[model samples]
Target chain A: MKKDKIINRRDFIQTGIRTGIGAGLGIIGFGLISRSVEGKTIWQLDPAKCVQCGNCATECVLQASAVKCIHVTDMCGYCDLCSGFFRPGALELTTGAENKLCPTGAIVRTYVEEPYFEYRIIEELCNGCGKCVQNCGAFGNGSLQLQVRQDLCVNCNQCAIARSCPAEAYSRVEPETAYLLKGFEELKITD
Target chain B: MQQSIKHIKERYIHLTTIIIGCCIFLFWLFYNPVHNFTEAVPGLDNRPPRSSSLGSEVIIGEHFTFFGNAPDPSLTGRWPNFRGADFDNIAKDNVELIDSWPATGPEIMWEKDLGEGHAGVAIYEGRVYVLDYDERKERDILRCFSLVDGTELWRRGYSVPVKRNHGMSRTIPAVDGEFVLTMGPRCHVMCCDATSGEFLWGMDLVKDQKAEEPLWYTGQCPIIDNGVAVLAIGGNALLMGIDCTTGEIVWQTPNPDSLRMSHSSVVPMTIAGKKMYVYNALGGLCGVSAEESDKGKILWTIKDFTPNVIVPSPVYVGDNRIFVTAGYGAGSALVQINKSGGSFSARTLQIYKPSEGMASEQQTPLFKDGHVFNIQTKDAGTTRNQFVCCNPDDFRNILWTSSTTERFGLGPYIIADDKFYIMNDEGELTIARFSTSTFEVLDKAQVIEGDDSWAPMAIADGRLIFRDSKKMVCVDMRANE
Candidate 1:
C-alpha cells in the first residue's frame, strides 16, 4: 500500500510542475499579443513634406517600388492643359509620346466635358519617379502624390526607401492611417 | 615555289574580276537617276491632331463641383449687395459690437484659403458668396460657404483663361434671398440659386453685348434691384436691366457717345427729386432713369468731371451736387445738376487738384452728416494717404485728417457700430471712432498675414467677412457681454 501511495505522490508532483510551466507560458503569450495589438505600426509618407527626390523609385527593395502615385480626384482641377500630364513647354498637348510627362506613360488623360480633362494613373507602369507630381504642385492643384501600396509592400523591418528619403517625410504610422493624403481635410466625401 | 606564286596571282586576278562585275551589276540594279520631290499632302502621315485647343470656347457655368454640405445654420443676417442693402458702406443692423478691440483683434471665427484674388464677399441669411478665379484650372468659380464655420458648400465654375492682372478676380457678388449674381474677371455674368448652387443663367457680356473688357479686368459689381439685374454695359449699351426671373433684357439705354466701361460700379442715387442710376463711365458721368415708365433713359450727362481712368463712383450730396474723384493726379470735382421743366443741365460747381482738395485714389468718399470722409491719394501733398474729413458745403474747409503715422493703403473701409473699420495693404485693421471733428483710433491689430487686403468687407449677424489676396477670414465682432 505504501509503495502504491509513494508512486501516486510522485505522479502528482510531476503533474504540478507541468501545470505551473503551462500557466506561466500562457500568461507570457497573452502579454505579448496585447502589446503587439497596441503598438502595431506601418510605414507612411507625408506627401506635404515630400520633395519628389526620385529616391523612392531606386531605393525600394522591390523590383518595382511599392510606392505608387495616388490621385486625389476631389482636389484635381480637371484642367485641359494639365501640368501633370504634359511636359513643360510641350509643343502640343496631346496623347503623343513626345508630349507625355511620365517616362513610362502611366498617366491617362480623359475628357470630362467641353474644357475639363480628368487624369488617372495606371499602377502597373508607375515607377514612382514623381516628375509629374513635382510639376503639378508647382503649376496646378497638387492633387497627385506618392503613397506606399500596402498590398505590394513587403512590410520590411526597415523600409529601404524611408532610409534614403532626403525630405524625411517618412514615419511609422498605424495601419488605419497608412496613407498621409492632402486635401482630405478640406473635402468631404459625398454621393 | 615559282609555280605556286604564279597560281596565287592568277587566283587573285580572277577574284578581282568577279568583284568588279558584281559592283557594276549592283549599281545598275539600285541606282535611280531621276530626282523626285513632291509637296507632302496634309494628313498623309498617321499622326493624330493635337487636342490642346484649350482656353477658347468656354461656355459660362458649364460645370459644377459640389462638396458635402453641412447642416444649414439658422442665422438670419444679410449684407445683400456690394455695399449694404441701403447702398452705403455701413452696417445698419443692430448687432452690438465691442467699443474697442482686445489688442489681439476680434475673435477670429474661421479662416479659409481662397484662390488668389481680391474678390469681395456677399452675405445672405447664413451663406457667404465670393467670385474666385482658380488659377490652376483657368476657371471662374463662384463659391458658397457656410457663414458660421467657413465650410465650402459648393462651387459653380466655368473654364475661362484669365491671365493674372494684379490678381484675377476684382468684383463682389450680389446675393438676394433666392439668387446670387457674380461678374467674373472676364466680364462673364453668372447667376445661381443662392441655397442650392444650381445654375440659373449666365451671360458673357464681352461676347453678347460687345462690352469692352476694362484694363485689369472687370471691377464692376452687379446689383439686383426690384427683381431686375442692372449692369452698366459699356460698348453697345450704356445701361441694361435684365429681368431676374426670365433672363431677358427688359430695358437697355443706347450708347450714343461710345462711352467705354470703367473700373467703377453703378451707384443708385436720388437727386433733384429724381431716382436714377449714376454711373461714372470712362468718357463721362451720366445718370440713367430708374423709373419703370422711363427706365434706362438717359437723364443727364456731364463730361467735365470724366477722368481718363475712373475708379470711384460719383457720390451724390444734397442740393443737386455730385462729388467725383480719381487717382493718378486726376483730382476731385463737384458737379451741380439743375432740372427745370423736364430738362436737365449740369455744370461743374468746383474742381480742384488732388493737392488742393479731398481726393481718393481707389475707394469712393463716404458722405455722411454733411461731411465727406476719404483716404486721400498719394499725391495729396501733405495729406497723402491720410484719412481726411471735409465739409462738402465748403471744399476748402478740412475738418480733420488722420495723423501721418495712421495712413492707409488702397484697402477698403466700412462704418459699423458707429466706428470705422479700415484695413491696410498688409492686413492691419484699425478701428477709429466715427467723428467729424476729430480722429480717435480705438484699437488696431494685424488681422491677416498677406499683402493687398484691398477687397471690401461684409458684415452681418456680428460676423465680419474679409479677405486678403489669398485668404478669407471670418471674425465675430460681437461684444463679449
Candidate 2:
C-alpha cells in the first residue's frame, strides 16, 4: 500500500510541472495574437511620395495627432545647422524655444562634435505637424520624416488626416511594413 | 520836444531790430540741414524683407555646415565646372545609358523640394553642388550632395532677403578641386572650400565693384580658371579675375565703352592659337585677351550685333568664326574674327531673323559634328519651339526640325551617350537621337509636374538631374537596370 502511494505522488508531480509549462506558453501565444490584432493594418506614410504638407499638424482625431518626426541615424548628415532643429528665422544656433524649428520644440539636438550633431524627438512633445520634415528635405538629406505612431493612433475607420492629404501620402500598410522608414534599404517607387 | 523825439526814435529802432532777429532765428530753425545717417555695413546688412535693389547687403561667412558621408570615387564622371569641363553642355560619361526609358519612365533615384529658381548644378568627383535661394530663410545657400544617392553633404550661406523677380538664384556654382564660386542674385560673390563647408571669402560686386544690377538679378554664372574666379563684372571693369584663395583682384579689363552687364556668362575660346575670353555684354559683344601677357586687354569687339537682352554666351566655331544669338526679336548673328600680324579684327558675317533660320530664346545651341541644334524661339512662326538642326556652313539651309507633335519650350537639352535629352517648360522630357537627315524622338516622359522646368540639365555617372521652378530630381539612366 505504501509503495503504490509513493508512485501516485511522483505521477502527480510530473503532471503539475507539465501543466504549468503549457499554461505559461499558452498565455504568451495568446498575448501575441491579441496584440497583432489590436495593432493590425494601421495608417502609415509613404516616405517617398510624402510632400511634407502641414496637414499632419491638424486634422487628427486626437487633439495632438499621433504623427511625429522619425530620424534615420544612418542617413543623417549631422549638420550643426540642422534644418529640422532650427527655425527658419533663427537669429543664432542655440537651444532657445524661439530658435527651434519644431513649433512645440519636440526635437532635441545634442552636440556630437565640432561639425556633427545628433537629433532626437521627444515623442511626448511632438504634434506630428510635418514642418520639420519640409525644412529637412529642403536643406538636409531628408533624414527626418513624418510617421503615424500606431500606439497613439486610434485606428479610425475614416482617417481625418488622409481625407485632407493633397499628395495622398497616407495609406493603410501591412503590419510588417507598418512604418515607411527613411533608412529602409529599399524604397517602394510609386506613380 | 527834440529830446523826447530822439528818445522815441531810438526806442522804435531797437524794437525793429529785435523783430528782424526773431524772423531770422525762425528761418534758421526750419532750413538747417543736420543729417541723420543709417550707414550700411558693406557685406553685412541684417537682411530686411523686400530687398530687391543692389547693395542690399547680406551677412557673409554667417553659416557653414557639413552633412552626409562621402561616396566612393570610382568611374565617377565629373561635370566639375559649368557646362562640363570643356565649357560645353555635354556629358563625358562612357557608361552605357538607356537610349529609351522603361514603361514606368526613368527611375527617380531621389527627389528634393527646391525653392523657386532655375539654378543649375555641377558635379565633381562624386558630389553635386548647387547655389539656391531659400525664400523662407531669406538667404542664398550653396548646398552640396552625394551624386549617387542625393544625400546632402554640406551647405554654406548668408542671409540676404530677395523678392521673387521672375525667380531667384538662376546661376550655377562653379566648382573646382579646391574651391567653389557662387554669384548670388544680388551680386554677392562667395567662395568656399569644395570638400568642407569652410567659408574662404566673400565680396559684394555692387558695393566694391559698382556693378549695375541686370534687369533681372545676376544671371552671369561665375567660372573658375587656374584657381581664379573669372567674372564679367561690367562695372568699372568690363571683366575681372579674383584669386580664389586670397580674394584679391588679379586682373581687370577696362570698360571703356561702359558696356552694361548682360545675363550671359563668359566663354573661353581658342582662335588662331590665341585663347580669349568672349563675353556678350549689354551694349556689345567683345573678346578679351586671356593670355598671361595681356590678360585683361580687349582683343576685339563688335557693337552692331548688340542686343539689350543677351542671355546666350558666344560660341566659337572652327578657326575664325564666333556665333552670337539672342531672344526677344533680337535674332542671331555670326561674327568673323581675322588675325593679321598680331592685330585682331572682327566683323558681322551673317545676320538673320528668327523665321528665316535658327534662333533660340534661352539656352545656347549645341554644336556637334558640323551641325548646330537649337529649339527655335516662339517668334519663328510655324517653327516655334521646334528642335531644329542646321548645318553650320549655312544657317539658312532647311536641315530638319522635330515635327509639330513634340514641341519643347525654353527647357534644357544635353547630349549623353549618343542621345538627345530634351526637356520642355511643361516638364516633359523627350529622348531623341542626334540626326542630321531627319528629326526623330525615341521616347517621352514627364519628369516634374511643375511648370517652368527651364533649368539646364546636368548628368554625371549615368545620373541625369534637372529641375523645375519648385523641385529637382535625380534619375538613374544606367543600362541593364
Model 1 chain B scores worst on lDDT over the 10 consecutive residues at: B37-46
Best by lDDT: 1
> In model 2, what are the clashing residue pairs, if there are any?
none
Once fitted onto the true fold, the runs of candidate 1 whose alpha carbons sit more than 4 angstroms away are A1-191, B1-55, B68-73
What is the C-alpha lDDT profile of model 2 across A1-191, one tens digit per residue?
Answer: 46554458788999999999999999999999989777678798787778877788788889788888888876676765576787653545567666677877677777653335678888988888888887676445588889898888887888899999899998998877778887645433431
Compose the digit string of candidate 1's lDDT tens values, residues A28-107: 99999888667788888899999899998999999789999999998887765677887754545567777678987788
Q: Tens-digit lDDT track for model 1 on B179-226?
A: 889898878898888888888888888778989777567889999988
TM-score of chain B of each: 0.87, 0.87
